[model samples]
Target chain A: MAMYVVGHKIPDSDSICGALAIAYLKNQIGEEAIPTRLGDVSPETQFILDKFGFTAPELKMSYAGEEVYIVDHTEKTQAPDDIDEATVVGVVDHHKLGDLTTSTPLECWIRPVGCSNTIVKMMYDFYNVDIPPAYAGIMMCAILSDTVIFKSPTCTTADIKCVEALAEIAGIEDYKALGMEMFKVKSAVQGTPTRDLVMRDFKDFDMHGNLVGIGQLEVIDLSVFDEIKADLAADIIKLKEEGKRHSVMLLLTDIMKEGSLMLIASDNETIIADAYGVTVENNEVWLDGVLSRKKQVVPPLQDGFANA
Target chain B: MAMYVVGHKIPDSDSICGALAIAYLKNQIGEEAIPTRLGDVSPETQFILDKFGFTAPELKMSYAGEEVYIVDHTEKTQAPDDIDEATVVGVVDHHKLGDLTTSTPLECWIRPVGCSNTIVKMMYDFYNVDIPPAYAGIMMCAILSDTVIFKSPTCTTADIKCVEALAEIAGIEDYKALGMEMFKVKSAVQGTPTRDLVMRDFKDFDMHGNLVGIGQLEVIDLSVFDEIKADLAADIIKLKEEGKRHSVMLLLTDIMKEGSLMLIASDNETIIADAYGVTVENNEVWLDGVLSRKKQVVPPLQDGFANA
Candidate 1:
């Protein structure tokens, strides 16, 4: 039976590209794997795919009674609803360990890096498997998207080295220019629905039994959301009630400014207030130097919830 | 600060040698690491270390406020009681994923292999670090012990290949003779107390909130335990009550016969009877072709407990 390699819901560039690259690598190593996605591709990812001459992964939701290789994420909230029924054969992730258990041994390659593709690149080198040019191009774009063009705090030396190597294979001379072009597509939110923009890069976490939702939107300029902050806030409030979550937050991150405008809708406001030692005024706060949610946002919120 | 590399409480050959080899590899990569043991060294492991001219690892129980790398086991039950207070830097395991979660990303290398030392051997190759001859000799012995001289079902091509490569590095022409010599030392339970014999290779598990204890003793001849079966049964009963465990079972495995005589004392005997579809008489049953506790025993018992 072929194992379905899939990534988290609300898929981003890393989630999509990592699945495709990992599935390809597993197939090269004599394992039958099919890359699948849980959600629609974003504009940024679509641009990268078109530029690299690769097609989008097949969309799949249910995986009960099938074997899976999870990439990019390990949390149950981000997985398919019936993930407990599926057998996870392996996991290649770059996130904190989440609540997943297995009855058998598995191939687990988890590292603390900026992007999952960095670890996937290491796996390709470890197995002595050559990456195709298109795959390398797509993977390089994933690292660029994840690390915010090497400006995010999560960016590491491994990520930079991987991107440089991948760019050489991709025959791209100005990868940073390509990254800016992709970000230009991602920054366009004028006609997008408030809910769609919020759900694009959203993730839910179980913090001390409390369901907390967090979303991020990266753009070249933060001023674009000034006209729609109220709409985004209203949709975030609706999402909190719809999901029965304790809190929902969205980060409007400006790449040029290297900061975020955090919008909050929560049952307990102090959960966010005490986490970063900042005041939440008018349902929002400007967090200076907050670009990486996995590094700067989730950890403090998790600690705050633990205390609560 | 130097990270401490340690293993499970009941230190087996794989556990001890894996800690040593991983710590050595980490130090070679410019990280300070010290090998530590959770309990006293076993006779077989001590024999191998002495033959390889290596000292036993330091004995330490508490790891509060320390950074440590866990090897051989990932279970909270098998770890130190104060493990929650410590920071787990990484884990290199070869068992089913137990209930261990981290708040930060970690370097995890968990594979479905025969021995933790087999995974450690791969790690050495991954980092391009050369293993010392003494370490290679001990690691080869660990693979032999865990795989029952390549007779256990858990043994795979990877495990055999690792042992062969390690033997050449250790300058050992006939490693099978060394394995036999080690087994002779392991089979001597004549003068040991029944309680000591039972606790030598024992581990406790949390099965759906029910505490279960399982121990294994491998020998060339099963008849050596014939004279002490009743005494062993009494000790198991005492252990169950003392630890407030739901059950305590011991496996007297005959490596030559490729079977085990399971002596169980449980609050509900059907937990064992239904797991393997056997009839228990006088707290004793014979299991044919049951060699690996992890592969053949734990999964079935886990299922039975889940149903219960």
Candidate 2:
């Protein structure tokens, strides 16, 4: 049976590159698998794909009645639209286990690392398959993006070790320069569409039957948020209305400052206020020392929804 | 910080032996960890411990405000009483992810292998730690018990490979003899108390807010169940009443016939009848080709409960 290897919706650099890397490794071990994407690639992911001389994976909106292997995520909502109908053969992820259930037992490799590519790199080593330099380059870029060049709090020693080893394999001598190049593309928000900006790295969650969506963008400066604050808030409202999410948030993460300015658009403003324990002023609030979305953004929203 | 390595409640041989083996490997790697059990040990696990010259781990009823690394199972109901209050450092398991949520990110190694001990055995190889003969013997017994001597449908190639390697390490030339030796101890029901017989290898699950408990025993002969059928039913009712379980079941698995005679005590008998499409005959029914509790028994029961 043909197997589709895909990442989560609103594909980030790590999910896109990690899916490709795992597909490559699986095919090397005599499996019939091909890389696919659940959503359009972000600019940073597109830039990395171009730099590594690889084409973007074909977009797969659904996998009904087919075999698929998920990478970078295990959440059913973030997976392909018809994930419940598909036969999930395997999963390689680096996130909290969401409400994804499989009818049959399958291989799953989940680790608490910074990037899903870190787990894929270990899989290559375990299978004794030599990773191609292009795959290594993209994998390295994914690690850099997900870990925010080792500045994110989720960065671990294993992530650092894998970054160094993968960098060596990719013949990357100046890791900082490569990371900055990727970040330059990530922060190029001038003239970008407001909807694209809000949907770049979006993730949807089901918190006690409430649909919550959070979008994040990391940049070296916070002035970009000041320039597009109103438009971003409008886009958030539009997205929330269209998707019927209980809350839609956009996190303007200042990587250099290790803080985020969160813009919220929801029917219930008290949920946001109670979530972060801060007044929602002008539909926005500054959150100091909020770097990791999985750790910082999601849990409190869940708690707030629970309380509400 | 002291790390208490623990297994799930209703500790089977795989869980009990896997916890001890992981604690041994962790301590060898310059970490302070001690194996602990959430519930009393079974006679089969006790037999393996005795054969390996090891003592049963101290009972750890709660892990309130402590650091812990869990093994064998990851379901919150199977975990310690105060798992939500504990800081989970890591997890090494082989079961489906349940409702166990950690406050912070932690290392989790979950695979699709049949036995948790198979994953622990791989860790020994990964860390380059030579397994002691005693640990190897116990690990072998764990694999044998969990996989039902490679008869259960959950048995994978990894489990078979680990069983063979562990058997070699334990210097056992005849794996069948060793497996039968273990099963003989498991099926010894004569003169045993009714509660002990049913509680030997029991597991409790919260199926959509319903407290469901299943107790299983693998026997070479079916006559043993005929002798204790009435008492087994009585004990199931008593345990369900005392434990406040919504439903309690006893699976008398005849390994020789590769089927199970299920005795169920529940407020709703139609759920079981609808789950397997078999009529409930005097509080029991014969289930042909039902070898795995996880793959066969639990999933259908869960579906039945959901429908109910």
Candidate 3:
């Protein structure tokens, strides 16, 4: 049977590229695997795929009775809805270990790094399989996107080294220029729907019995979002009601400014206020020098809900 | 602060040697680590360590404020009593993913091989660190013990290849002879107490809200346990009552005959009887070709209880 390689929902560049690269590696090692995604590709990811000469992965929402190899994330909330019916054969991730359990022994390769593509690069080296140049190009772009162009605090030396090596393999002389070009595509929000922007990188987390939805939108400049912050906040309120979530937040992150403007829509704002030790005004707050959500935003919210 | 490298309770050869080898590798990579154990070293493990000129690791039962790297097991039932209070920085194992969650990104290396020592050997290769002769000898012995000298169904080609590589490093030409020697040490039960024999290699599992304790003793001849079978049953009953467990079982496995004589002491015999589809007689039943407690035993019982 062909195994499916997949990543979390609200697929980001790293998740999509990691799935594609891992499926390619597994096939090279004599296993038939197909890359899959839980959601639609965002504009940034679409740009990288077109630039690197690759198509988006097949959209697969359910995995009943199928075999899968999970990548990028381990949380049950981020998995397919019927994931309990599928068998997880392996996992390659770069996050805190979440509440995912497997019945049989599995191949798990998890590490503390900025990007899942770094671990995928390590897997290629482990198997001594040469990656094709196009795969290397997308993987490099994934690292650059995930680490916010090496500005996120989660960026480690291993991630930096992997991006450089991947760039060399892809025959790209100026990878930084390529990263800036990709972020420029990400910052385009002129005609896109507000709800689409809010759901661009959204995920639901079960924090102490409360379901919280968090999203991020990275751009080169913060001024572009000054016109639609009210619309984003209203859309988040609708999202919270529809999903029956305790809170919904969207982060408008300016990569060049190295900060995030957080828009909050919640049942009670005290949780977020007390968690970050900041007061919220007008349903929004400016978080200085906060770029990485996995490292900076989620942990304190988890702690806050846990204590509450 | 020095990180502690430890294994699960009931310190078997694989668990003990894996802790030592991983701690050594971490130290070689410039991290300060100390090997620790949750229980006393069994006679078979002691023999292997003494032969390899290494001492037993320090006994540590709690890890309240310390950082740890778990080996051999991932289940919460097998972890330290205060595992929730400690920080798990990494895990290296060859078992099913268990219910252990961490709040921080960790280094996890889990594979579906026969033994944890095989994974440790791969880790040694991963870091390009040379293994000491003593470590190699003990690691080879651990592989032999866990895989039952390649007779176990769980033994894979990777495990055999690792043992061969480790044996060459340990300067052992006839590794099979050394394996037989280790089993001989494991088969000795003339003067050992019934409780000690039962707890030699025991672990507890949560089977659908029922805590089940299972132990295994591998020997060359099953007849050696004929005289103490009744005493072993009584001890298991006592263990079940004392620990408030739903059931306790002991497998007297004859390695040469390639079968096991399972003794059951349970709150309800139908659970085990229906699991393996066998009719129990006098609290014991002979199982043909059941050398692996992990591959052949646990999965069926877990499924049986889940269905029941």
Q: Write the per-residue lDDT of candidate 1 for residues B4-101, one digit (tens) a residue.
A: 99999989988899999999999999999999999988889999999999998999999988998999877899998888778788888888878877
Ranking by lDDT: 3, 1, 2
- lDDT string for model 3 (A61-180, tens) is 989899999998889999998887788999999888888887778999999999999999999999999989999999999999999889999999999999999999999999999999
lDDT of 2 at A304: 76
Give the worst 10-residue stretch by lDDT in candidate 3 chain B.
Answer: B95-104
Clash total of candidate 2: 0
Pick the winner on TM-score between candidates 2 and 3: 3
Candidate 2 — which pairs collide? none
- Tens-place lDDT per residue, model 1, A115-224, is 99999999999899999999999999999999999999889999999999999999999999999999999999998988999998999999889999999999999888
| Index of the highest-lDDT prediction | 3
The worst-scoring run of ten residues by lDDT in candidate 2 chain B lies at: B96-105
lDDT for A297 in candidate 3 is 94
Which should have the higher lDDT, number 1 or number 3? 3
Best by DockQ: 3
Q: Which 10-residue span in candidate 1 chain B carries the lowest summed lDDT?
A: B97-106
